[model samples]
Target: MRKIFTLLTIATALLMAQCNQPEQKVDVSPISDATVKKVTAELVKQHGDSQKERIERGVAQVAMLWRITDGTETDFEQFCTTQFVSDDAALEQLFNKLSYGFEMLNGYFILLSKELMKPLHLDWGPVTPIDELFGSYNAAAHLNDDLYANKIAFITALNFPYYTLKEKTEMGENWSRKQWAYARMGDMFTSRVPAQLIQNFSTVNTNADTYISEYNIYMGNLVDDKGQTMFPADMKLISHWGLRDELKSHYANKEDGLAHQQMIYQVMKRIIDQSIPQQVINSNEYKWNPYTNTLTKEGNEVQATPEPNTRYQHVINQFKALKAIDEYTLKMPNYIQRKFEGEFELPVDEVEQLFIDLVSSKEVREAGKLISQRLGRPLQPFDIWYDGFKARSGIPAEKLDGITTKRFRDAKAFEAELPNILTSLGWSKEKAKFIADRVKVEASRGAGHAWGAEMHNDVALLRTRVPASGMNYKGFNIAMHEFGHNVEQTITLHDVDYYIMHGVPNTAFTEALAFVFQKRDLDVLGMKEVNPDKEYLETLDNLWSCYEIMGVSLVDINLWKWLYNNPNATADEVRNATLTIARDIWNKYYADVFGSTDEPILAIYSHMIDNPLYLSAYPIGHLIDFQLEKQFRGRSFAAEVERIYSQGRLIPQLWLKKGVGEPLSVTPILEASAVAVQKLSEKK
Candidate 1:
């Protein structure tokens, strides 16, 4: 055996949910052990000891997933003997081939899914029942099973033994780009889950996404107890991003600001409590004042029913479907481990701690005090979203909307200026055009998202809500954010060294760049902020907004923990628990700052209902955004963006260290924020 048993054990212990349980060693039949030993001996004799450790680990890892149905022990030995590449050049060649093959298989399937879900994703009239079915369908569900059956999967796994997250983090720094690519290749075939369970997981998540996408609150239909309307008659806001942004916009509202803010706040509470009239969800049949929980249509007050725990139903359904996958992923045994350690490459505990450090910081109380002083009033629960840092927040909301609507007019009009938008951010025209040409913009059914191409030739899709009238200020801002993602996607995909490594480490890194672009939305529109204290305000903005999202993310994490502990929790049980968790987080971190206790405002994120465990990215992204912003202060924005993003999919800490000067930490942001608070306080 090779002298690296420790790494092999670590590599094999890639359990999701951080299951500390011992990995069940593959109980190979005696014949199997004999065959593996025989193969390793011969391969060592042929390849020499330099390749000994890798050969021993690779052969055993592949054999671990092998079954009697995959053929007799003799067949396994024969396959290994035939497949094992002793020559270094040949093995490298095989890895490259596998990488390209995977790109094709994964890429085309993703594109197909994107096309099939177009009806559900795009604002193409109305979504049909069949569209939901198609959208929920996992087009690539059988790809894994088929690959396993065909032995291609076994071959890939044999050549490229999967490295565990720990092993990757430990050894990845010393690895060459190709070696890292090979390790990522090893990640391809770690599980042998049935296709049906995967389809169920897909269906549950798809349903949740659909539920959230259609969950529009008719803001215009929202009325106060005194029967006054504040929003535009045609305005329908999606919960809770649209509603949240709309609430943020009210900071600029001189006359009706506080009332609109209060109204939106009430609306959020109703949704969270499931007390919002069911009729007002995605319908214009009635006007409702969320404050009194009252419903009316035209001149007549109407009867109403509450939304029957559908939100929590989605959460529990996702919990059930994903939990079923736990038994199959014996290495990473649960969804929590799979999501954080596997997908995000972030440990749940570490992510949670980072969040708590920010939310529970003295900086948050200082930020709240700053907002209070500025508003000349005490903090409201909704003031967690204080949006005064951005240049547009100082401009009248209507004026900014006018400027954006005039500039964009429609999705195509915005699409036409993609290059100009990039150039405005200091990119050279050539580079801007290169990226813009490969990005396609479209109107979306939901708030919006950036969908990157899995294959290089494919264009990145930027989807954002463009109302029938025009692209409003909110839409433009989101589009700019998505555009940032698209740029990252294109650069990391088209310009990086390896197809397998062609993306940021995780969504947060992309989001960091997106936030960077989003902050410059005013600059892109020729409305730059001239405030000398703007940078300090921006730091406070980053910290405070991060504080708000951190609370929500803590709720998300705790809710998952609750689900895992109580696997059979009913929808109502999950609902009640979610509220309790939200309030607990709020009280722990936010009560003193916001002067509220048991506030369920933390439960208002739509991501919790649909995105499951994804809320953590926003806060982490904000931190990354702030740190990356620090990097660009004395540097060229365009150059650093290209250089930083082109590094492509290293682990988070490694990527941060290489991109910025430090690892992913709150110390920089917290320190800067303390100074910012002092400076701002002195100015006041």
Candidate 2:
């Protein structure tokens, strides 16, 4: 907590620095309505100056205000919007000034983190300065960008808690600064895992090229909430391709990238810090602790905490427990699972082969053919799912939607059924009653997905923002998905230690937990009963979904690289690059099924423009969900479900390891799909 506070102090200092310097000669008196007119006139004269000059003058003008803080915001707003200075560029510059200040504050908060652990007794090496670690440079050295570059520079210029204002304002770098650099570096490199990948890191794991494609498809879909394509035919050239060769030099190595990643996570973490449980702090006992850490609170003897590097290992252990279920999913396959109409079973080996065949099936091949002809590019296997998935589960997809709409449209209707849903899953009446009481569902017209926001208090909020258009099958599924998130949210946060951490490890980790429910959602709706045949279909769906997103993520990674490399690329060029990426992924992965010359479906994804570097989670979630499901299969559903969800938020990988007895891996995807395919084939 002390460390976190220190980090926050630095951020505070950055925000404070945004004001006029104390050394400047200026009045401190509050400005009145009359003064606004006078100052507005002077600012108008300065408006014609260069951007820097305008900023300097504004700073000096602000210096004169003695106790002027009261109405300064209003006065400034009035002045800016007055007839005297309405230049768009001028307003933009002002925005830049304000934004720079905001970014500094954002960065400062980001530097603070609860994840820090006690250093290992073993000394490693000399601490590095923050500037050197992150390649800090003076204003002269920083490159100019529309936004990010400026924000980064302003943040770096601020002082840390250990340093006084004078020392912080010093122009030159120092040894202390270097230490900050090293810690920041360490934080970045170690955020998730060293091996944990970025968007375009590799094809074997969650590939970037595939992700980008999927992003585009989702983004495209989001354009028209009414299930209409928002993209124009001619504007399809902005897609991301493998621009790694271009982006590699800029970022250099893992350290640089990790630093940025950590920065984003840290900043967002701070903004939402209030929402996080206090029990997560490095403390022995406190009320409001999450349930998972209660064991520690109940005991007086404190277990020795692991050293920093190894500390993550405990979290990893937890991650394994959560992820152990991935292995079980790998046994289910797609083809045989889909082929079975009702009760059926097949040898696991047969399921695996059938899964492979389904991935390369003729229908999947045809989907590629359709996409390639439409987009004028070769098809990829990843592109198959967004299309094939729709094609395969046509009626079921619609039916699921109908189920959600019927249940969700009337909040009370769903609430009444929730108790049954929970109890049927084996929850005791008391436990079921508790959940039923806390759950609150809301829906609104929106393009983004539903989310469960856990508040600081005992109460939890499960809100879904639906597109303004009427709810559809897709909307229903998304709603159900969010419902799963809310369920995990309630169990983990409400039941955990009030002071201890109570939440999923990361967005992906939570997604994994929510998916467990989503997979079972069909059962909840009685759409896909847990009969042998339905289980087989579910397995097939999982494999297809995972395989498709792997390709989509690939595209997403490449597109970012493209943007990084060709910063000046026209929309058309970006679109062309996207087309090329789609073709490349499709040809390589789907050529066997769809033919070597077919086009890819990446063009249809809606996420490309809306969310960046986010498509990979679907596959990862699938891989994790199946594994977690296996652990609870034979157990008393409610007891095991509560125990698992009760773990709340731990470092994702570490949490799984502890809970599931294994490391995070993709075996679950391979095994489950294979088994489902074999089973479905036998049914036919």
Candidate 3:
């Protein structure tokens, strides 16, 4: 019921004893099988052959879910007999009413949820545990109970019996918009998870989010083996994002750039291993020597405790919470199946194969060779984040920061500049104004995010880390990414014909657009790429990016697989397992080129803690972005984007085919990347 435009996260556990638990599937129908069959036949006999198919399906569907408290067998029979609409006009009318009703219900709950999360998400004052408690409180947690109690869920389910993802994909090819909407309506009540369990999931996830959001590292306090401080005294970077971006920015530093990158890599390793001192996390109180693993105060060595595996502990908490949901999801029995087929509209194996294919291809080796030649050195583990291809990479960080801070002194300034940013990307003035009017800008608490509106009139949120001083270059680039999400959100919601088909298939689709916009950040600043082979360079950049994150995603996937297998694993066990998994993936795909066989640098992605299994979306989004960019050749960028997104929520394959005339495969970029590598190498 709650519409969360968040970083994608959801999942849980096992096969042998999966359905054996006594309490599992306790919500079985109290109505007898004989009664259900008899009622179905009677409803069919009354409705005649033309209406017989729907009558039987609807009656049986309702009877199968009827409980003792809901009604007796006789009441179930009577309700089905009276409620079944045989006429086409009548059915359409009923469908319209139900659709409108649900939109109102789901939309307003989303609005409420946004307000509740504002304090935690926004830069509010020091949040108390009570604020976190309220933030976790999902108002729609019990909305399912209310719907079932009032028989709304039963009625909807009866009319539109649930279709599996396979069924939807196959049969949906011929179905009209109304039919697809009805199928989704059927999806509303496939299984009844208890309200308390939903609340539990919400609470667990919220706490994990709070943890990751506050996980900051004081970069200024870090020292090398020789007791040298290399960073600005006031520099503070949050886990993964700030640290990674800082590493990227140093590419222009030339002077001691490698040293800075190595230091950041060491810092990431400490974070991944949970050996970073507890006192140093999110604090500037202590000086740290990451290479030596020491903490000190005022030049005096001090005893500092490690983080005690809180990083992995939160993951286990999420795992256990998600595992508790296994029995409740009957169709897609396990978390993996549900996450891929149900939500992503793709299979896990399929997505994994796509990732694996690209990572293992000849294109990757060629790209790596090109990168190493450009760097004039052997590749390091941290080279996975090579950022030299972009147009702005040559520009000084201070120069970019000066421009960004001067232009966007505050959130309000950025808000006012949205229309211009939009127009810079080929959007007409009227269209730009329309989108900007519905986009709200705000200071974010974490590495920012975009929160889309639920209802038509509500404004979409663009949250970014605008410091008290001003927005920096990193913050500006991220803001552009979030702005892409806001644009997609506004378009899909306000322009789509059906509320049920309002968004793109999943978060990955939005991520694709965000990547697209992010690629154009410099263009928005009137800093066009001067390099002749910019497109080819951009292609290589995306390939390297995909190669890096795909390995990280493999680690995340395999880590969860390990957690499920070792259900009773302790925090320390998972921590050790995580490092092993990360190293294993790195060794398999990245070791030969990087000259490092067991580097756990990939495990440093913060998404693993707060947004499980979501790292895949980024790489997959990059793939889609490349393919879409290919199709967008010679087309008006703004016009085509509106056209593509306006196609609305369809299954991934179908959406890709309609949007780009090809199914989602990495071949486009892989093939193009090979050509790019050859071209750039020939020039050199």
How high is each candidate's TM-score?
Answer: 0.95, 0.45, 0.95
- What order do you get sorting by lDDT, best first? 1, 3, 2
Local accuracy by lDDT, each model? 0.82, 0.39, 0.82
Give one digit per residue, the lDDT tens place, for model 3 in 419-487. 999999999999999999999999988778888876777889888889877999999998999999999
- Top of the candidates by TM-score: 3
TM-score between model 3 and native? 0.95
Residue-level lDDT tens digits of model 1 in 118-138: 998898877888999998787
lDDT of 2 by residue, 1-684 (tens): 000111122221211111111222322335555655555455556664533333333332332322343246565445333423235565435434543453344333322211111011001222234412221111211111212222332222211112222232242133332333322211111001111111111111112212222221111111121223232222111122111111211122233432322222221222111222333222224221111212133323234332232211222222222122222112221212211210011222332333344444543344344445533445432334333222223343335446566665644455567777777667788888887676755442122233332333333334333333334445444455666666676776577542124455434555766666655555666654435465555555566565565666566656555554554455445556766876786676655654545354544343443333345455556656766776776777677667766665443444566566554556665565566555554554
Is 1 or 2 the stronger prediction by lDDT? 1
Q: For candidate 2, which ten residues in a row score worst on lDDT?
A: 189-198
- Determine which window of 10 residues in candidate 1 has minimal summed lDDT: 1-10
Instruction: Tell me the lDDT of model 3 at 207.
Output: 87
Task: Give the local distance difference test score of model 2.
Answer: 0.39
